[model samples]
Target chain A: MLENIISELEKQFQLEAVDHNSSDLVFLTIDRDHAVMAIDLLKWKFGYKHFVLLTAVDFLEEGKFQLTYILNNPDTKTDIGVRVRIDREDANMVSAHHLWPTVATYQRELKEMFGIDFPGSPRLNDPFILEGWEGTPPYRRDFDTKAFAASFYHQREGRTTNDPATYMKEKLYPNE
Target chain B: MSKKEFFPMDGDRTKYPEIKSDGTADIDLSSHKYIKLWHGPNHPGITGNMAVELTLCGDEVVEGITHVGYLHRGFEKLMERRKYIQNFPLVCRIAVPEPDYNEYNYATCIENLTGIDVPEKGMWLRTLTLEMARLQGFLMWIGGMAGAIGFGTVGQWANYCRDLVLDRFEELTGGRIYHIYILPGGVRNDIPEGFKDRMEKNLREIEGFMKDIRRAFFDNYVFKKRSVGVGYIDPAWVFDYGIVGPNARAAGFKHDIRKNYPYAKYAELDFEITTAKDSDIYTRAFLRFEELLKDIDLIRQILDKMPEKGDHISKVSNMMNLKIPAGETYVRSECTRGEYGYYLVADGSEYPRRVNVRGPSYTHGVALLEKMLVNVNIADVAQLMVSLHTYPPEIER
Candidate 1:
């Protein structure tokens, strides 16, 4: 079923079948230009109406973040994972909000977290986190977590707090 | 199939409320007819922090506005800062009422990425815990549903039974509500000595409690009248909205991930997938009734098939020493409400690069609630919320 769907998708979009392991499913990495169109076609032509998830990954070393859309077809019992790689220099893609209305909020969330621009999405301005955030997006791979946390958040001022295991050892057996 | 009949909502039509239209829909702010009522932040019927602004025309709701993110603590962003082991306790707060789901899915995602398989005995134990958690969640659902329809006695009875389940959790994990017991590699510990007998005793007590639940809740005429044709959904909407668990099952869809995906020991366990055909409040409520029985049977199966010799958890090095290879994985599980997915991105580090939770409540709260509230009466607001089982924290996360 996945092969059939991939074959059907390949006719329109520039698609490459990728390797993924979990259960019965096939993943394909597609060009960003055809991401929305391909997904719309799949949802319309095929029975893959369920938008399971929409997530983005930051690959700083590779200079790109991969955005994946996992869709499932309950009628056929087949799943398809389609991904689009957006370069860090121009992290933008046409929003799938038109085809799947549910993707609007998710796209806005991805924009806030990864700093990717979804030009067509209506709710991109809504604040999900970091009220009045300035400078860089907090979810980018290049964003240094320790530095950001130290500069922004309030830190403990006393001796370093120990973990659960260390705290148990220290409090329970003081002499030892 | 014929369309399901729903009770006519009682109320007058009013104007739109205070939500500024962001190019989606225009509101006539000049009109003085509409009254805005906020039902959120802290409310008896609502499970978590959520507010629904209803523009009422007398008793009827004209325009319903959903307000989420009151309890949003940025859990996904926080997951990026903590190590694998350090996140166990934090992720439990993602869904406060059903915290095991976050732990189980997070653990399963990491385990899938690291290629660490749990032992047979551990699998059985995890299944046992999952079923117990499902029962606890179902009882809470029943209580909340009953309370929504003014059946206060049902809430008392179901909550009383739920306390017994929480007692078992407190004995096992030292936490009544948020049991961070289901880790990635395996459970926190083996079932304690004579724990099976104790669990059996609790199940027997719950079994007796089910009788009262049927008598006071299901058998009651008032509840049936309130729930029989209320909050009707087209059965086909289950496929479109991707709803799961009892909600979809009640709508006549058999898309149980446990049966289809066969995670943990669910493949080995023999139990019926609870389903119904009415797609109304009563059928949704009845699905829970069938699920309670199935939960008991699955727990018994776990106790019978649990292996004798196997480690409860694998010995791993410190969190700093553990590193996941650079990859991405999405692991989904059948939670009490619906299908919950955890999409994680690992960059060969102790902390995940990205953790996006596809919580089920987000779908129900935003898309389904907005769609379902188009012509519903104001009185059915709490009932709709209860029947849909929307968790605001899960949505906000």
Candidate 2:
């Protein structure tokens, strides 16, 4: 079932890469421009009607943001994750709201959390899950959460916090 | 003269023009009437910590906008920094009412990434716990729905029944609200001695209450009149709005993660998907009631079919030094509300690279609520919101 979906997707678009990570999971990477087209093909041509999830992963060293769109077919119970890589400096992609209107909320969320721009989406720049947030997008790898917490939130004083690895080492090899 | 003299101010307004002249009395007769109203954030009718900004024309809403994030803690970022085992307790906090779905999804995702296979008894135990949690959530939903519609007694009865279920949980898991019982390899512990008998006793007690619940709540004519044809959702909008769970089932769409994409021991269970065609508050309520009954039957089947005794937790490496293989997987579970999925990315490190919770409430609470609120009667706002079963923590997270 998954193979059929993958072959159909590959036949239609020039997929940059396609890999099967595990059973019932298919990963396909395409250029940012073909994201909407690929998703439309998957939704209409293939029977993947459910828009399961949409999220972003920040790769600071690579200087790119990986946008994953997960679609599920109810009949086959298979999930196909469409991957699109956008430039970190100018993180922009076409909106999938035309296909699935609920993507507007997810796009709005990504815009707020990762600074990704979904140009044609409604309320793209609206504040979502963050009010008056004026710093680097919190989910980006470069954003220092510890530093942010120290400056903004109250921290307990006179208490030492150790890294998990350090704590594990001290506890496991106390005699050493 | 006698009636008018008794209450002079109650006469026709235009006949008695002096009443209109008073400073305190003012009436505007306009074709277009627009009043801005804020519906929540702390309102009793609100399901959780979220608000709807509604523009109403007299009694009909013109437009509605959802405002969330009153409970945002950036759980995704927080989980990314915490160790694998450290995240088990925190994931359940994402969905407060039904925490087992979150725990199961997170545990399964990690187990998938780490290549750990749970034993047969462990699978049955997880399924049992999942169904138990679903019943508890349905009980809470019944209470909330009844409360929304001015039936306070039903809420009390439902809460009492739910408390009995929680008592069983407290006995087995040692925690009432947040069990944190599901771990990566399997459940935290096996069921105690005579736990099944106690659970069956509670189930029978709930079964006894079902008849009274039907008589008082479901069979009442006032509830039917108030709920039927109210909060109508067209079947076409189900896909566009990402509706799921009982809401979609009420719309005559047979989309259930348990039946469609069976997880844990659901594949082995014998149960039918319950649905309705009305797509209104009444149908949703009916579907939840029927699903609750189905859950009871499912729990019985799980208990009967489970192995007598086996290892609940499979042997795994030390949790403190556990490192998952570098991979990404989207694991989904049939939560009480809908399809709750977790998109986990592991970079072979002590901490997760990213953990994105795809909460069903995110769509139901914000997008669908905003869309359905348009032109709806103001009286049905709370009914519509609760019928969708929106959990705000999932939305904000």
Best by TM-score: 2
Query: Which 10-residue window in model 1 chain B sums to the lowest lDDT?
Result: B10-19
- DockQ for the candidates, in order: 0.33, 0.54
lDDT of 1 by residue, B264-337 (tens): 88988887677888787788888878887788878888888887678988765564556899877778888888
Model 2: C-alpha RMSD to truth?
A: 9.8
* TM-scores, all models, native as reference: 0.87, 0.90
Per residue, candidate 1 scores C-alpha lDDT tens digits across A91-176 of: 89888877666777678778877899899786686765345777788778677777987997999888787799989998999889
- The DockQ score of candidate 2 comes to 0.54
Candidate 1 segments exceeding 4 Å error: A60-63, A88-90, A122-176, B1-6, B10-26, B317-320
Q: Output per-candidate TM-scores for chain A, rounded to 2 decimals.
A: 0.84, 0.84
Candidate 1, TM-score of its B chain: 0.92
Candidate 1, residue B63: lDDT: 64
Model 2 interface RMSD, in angstroms? 1.0
